[model samples]
Target: MSTVTNQAVGKVTRTRGSRAWRPYLYHIIVGLLSLLMIYPILWMAASSLKPNSEIFTQAYTLIPSKLEWNNYVSGWKGIGGISFATYYKNSFIIVIFATIGSVLSSALVAYGFARIKFFGSAFWFGCVMMTLMLPHDVTIIPQYIMFAKLQWLSSFKPLIVPFFFGVPFFIFLIMQFIRTIPHELDEAAKMDGCSKYGIFFRIILPLIVPALVTATIFSFYWRWEDFFNAVLYLNKAQMYPVSLALKMFLDGESISNWGGMFAMATLSLVPVILVFLIFQKYIVEGISTSGLKG
Candidate 1:
């Protein structure tokens, strides 16, 4: 019996040892991948701090030999033509309105699809799904012409208003998430004398916080990074977003301010990073819960 006990103890010890080593192996793999992902960002930050001369130098140093913080200062002032502050404001305004509009409109439309059964519901849903199959590039010219005819050119209206109508992808995502919730809850609410709007506002909205966060984060990121449309429709420099303003830093005629340009590029990425970090937990939870239900 003592020998058998010892044998069992030995097996348990081996299992414990394996478990400890497995985590270390995972850590090493993750560390390597993290370094791979972070290296470019580190290189960009280092280059931003270096003088124009040091950027192309043979030195493999991550730390700049001569740090010029003025690159950031000058970058903020922008090139000869524009100001980064104005661009920042423009981008912020567009992102705020677009994010709110997209989230609210998508949630409402999603609720309609998920909860209500009306005539041609499946057909309309199919149409919405088909929109996802069509590329935005394919519809850009028609959208641009429509906007131009409506005299929305050179304004933030084009960027902001479309979101209020609901984006197809976000609508689909939210609809899936809503469907994951049991219909019994809605029935119970209705039995308790709650109206459909009341059920939506009080119960459904609270439950789908994760989906809303995910949608908001996505919308904000897209609006912030939207340069193609900004360039296409916006003629006035004052109306350009940070995305377009960043391009002005590159002067192909003579010498581009590589340090300043990189500094601005790094700065440009901060809002996106912050927004992601803020809602990352909700985004993950929302997707996970939505998958389990549907």
Candidate 2:
């Protein structure tokens, strides 16, 4: 009986010990994968500090033989006498206005779809949802012609104006989030003599802060990194955003300033990283809860 009891205790101990190492093993694997994913970004940062001649020569090395801070200074000086500061200013102007427009318009439209009932509402909602399946590439030509006809080409209007109508993806995301809120709250606000706009502004808007923040972050990222639209609509070098300005480093007719390009590329990532770190929590909470019921 004593021997049997000892054997059973040893078996339980072995089983518990085996399960404990699994978590550690899982963490190690995940850590390796994360490192692999971020290695390119880390390498680029290191390369920015390397001598221009050594960048491609020692491409595999993450450490520079000697730091070259001049790369950043040269990059900031920019092309055609336009400084990086101008590019940054242009980028901020487009991103801020477009992000605000996207978030506010999306929220208002989403509220109507989720809470208010009107004639042909379901049909209109279906049309909005169907747009998610449509690619922006399909409509680019038509949009370009329309903007051209209005003489809005080569201007910021083409970049920022469309966002005022709301983004299809964000509209759906906010609509789903709004649907999760209890209707009783809206009814109660109405009983207190709250107007429709008051219910939206005072009650619904405040409750959906997480979703709004999520939309804002996404809109900021999209607008900040918009290269295709910038290149398509912007003709003047002085009017270029950072995304388009970066391309000026490449001189097809002469040697390209790759080191300067890499340096500015590293700097451009700062705002994006800061935004993500600041609002990451809301992104997770908003996405997870937005789908809870609707």
Candidate 3:
């Protein structure tokens, strides 16, 4: 019996080892793929340290022979009229307002959809989903015309105000997350004489911090990187966001400044990368646990 038990245990261990090896193989492949994806970004950072002459030299080296730290200082000063400081301030203002507006509006709308049962609730929910299916390109002209009529052109209002109305994708994401919270909690709050607003502020909001964080991160990134709308609406160079300001580095009529461009691009990515790293845990948790309806 002991000999038989020992043989069975050995076989089980062998099976477990094989299954573990399968995951390890996949992990190794994924690591290599990640490295491939990151190589371009790494190359860009390295190239930022190189001088203009070394950028396109025949004996192109990944490592710069002489680091030009002043490139960052010069890039921050920007080309002639526009300054990076102004663009950075513009980006910060837009991103902050937009992120706050998107998160708050989406959460409120999502709560209504997830918990409230009223006349035409289903129809409105369908409308929200339908809006998601429609491409933004199709509506851009109409939106532009509307904003133009309002005289919101060449200002941050175009970027900021629309976010106060709930975003369809964020609405859907938060609704799904809100639905996962047990209805019993709502009932319990009501039993304690809590009003709907009270329950939402006290009970629901705390539970959904991860989702809010995720939405905030997305909003910040989108608003920060937005270029097309900025170009379409903003005519003043000083009013431009960093994304639009970066275009000033191009000569348009002549060759572009590749080294300065790369340096600025690298600098632009730092804030985004830092924000993601800081809130990545919340994002992962929000995505993973948001589907479990309990």
Candidate 4:
């Protein structure tokens, strides 16, 4: 019996040792793939530290012989002497309001869909979901014409006003999460003489924090990266956000500053990266919980 057990233990040990290398190999492959995907961003950042003349010449090189720290200075000053600070300010203002509007409005709409009993609620919720499958390009021309008629052209109104209406994905994400929350809480609030508004403010809202943070992150990221709408509506350089302002670096001619553009581009990603790092846990929780309901 002892000899048989020893043989069995040796076989199990051999199997474990063989499988141990599989996880390491998997990690190695994943690491390589991740590096491959992010290599371009790394190269662009490295090139930002090089002189403008050396950008294309040293494109393949990951390191630079000379660190041209002045790229950041030149980029910040920008064209027309307005400075990138103005653009950064513009972006922050738009993102802050739009994010707030989107998350708040989405919560209200999602609450109605998830909890409130009303006539035609199903139809309205269906209509809202329909918009999810609708391509944004399909409505852009009509929206442009409408906004043009409203005299919202060349202003931030076109960008910020739309967010006051709930975003479809945000509504869906939040509604799903709200459904997972026990309805008993709302009833308990009502038993305590809580009104509908009271229940929302005192009970439901507190429970849906993860979903709200998720919506906020998505809203801020989309608004921060919104170059097309910004360019289309904002003709004046003074009103340009960071996304549009980045375009000023490239003139499609001999005058474009490649080094400065790369430097500014790298800087522009800082806020988004920080936000993600801060709220990554909430974002994951929101997504996971929202999925669990349906």
- In terms of lDDT, which candidate is strongest? 2
Stretches of candidate 1 above 4 Å error? Answer: 1-19, 58-60
lDDT scores in order: 0.89, 0.94, 0.88, 0.93
Give per-residue CA lDDT, model 3, range 1-294, as digits (tens).
999999999999999999989988999999999998998898889878888788778234578889988778778878776678888899899999999999999999999989988999989999989987898799899999999999999899998999999998888878889988889999999999999999899999999999899888888899899999899889998898889988988897987777777889998998899999999998888877666763
Model 2, position 129, has a per-residue lDDT of: 89
List the candidates' TM-scores in order: 0.90, 0.97, 0.89, 0.96
Residue pairs that clash (backbone atoms under 3 angstroms), model 2 = none
lDDT of 4 by residue, 1-294 (tens): 999999999999999999999999999999999999999889988988999888988788989989999999999998788999999999999999999999999999999899999999999999999999999889999999999999999999999999999999999999999999999999999999999889888988999999999999999999999998998888999999999999899997667988889999999999999999999999999999999976
Question: What lDDT would candidate 4 get against the real structure?
Answer: 0.93
Evaluation by TM-score, superior candidate among 2 and 3: 2
> Which regions of candidate 2 fall more than 4 Å away from where they truly are?
none
Model 3, residue 206: C-alpha shift (Å): 1.0
Candidate 2 on 1-294: residue-level lDDT in tens?
A: 999999999999999999999999999999999999999999889988998899999998999999999999999999879999899999999999999989999999999999998999989999998999998899999999999999998899999999999898999899899989999999999999998899999999999999999999999999999999999989998889999999999999998888899999999999999999999999999998898986
lDDT of 2: 0.94
Best prediction by TM-score = 2
Candidate 3, superposed: residue stretches over 4 Å from native = 1-27, 58-60
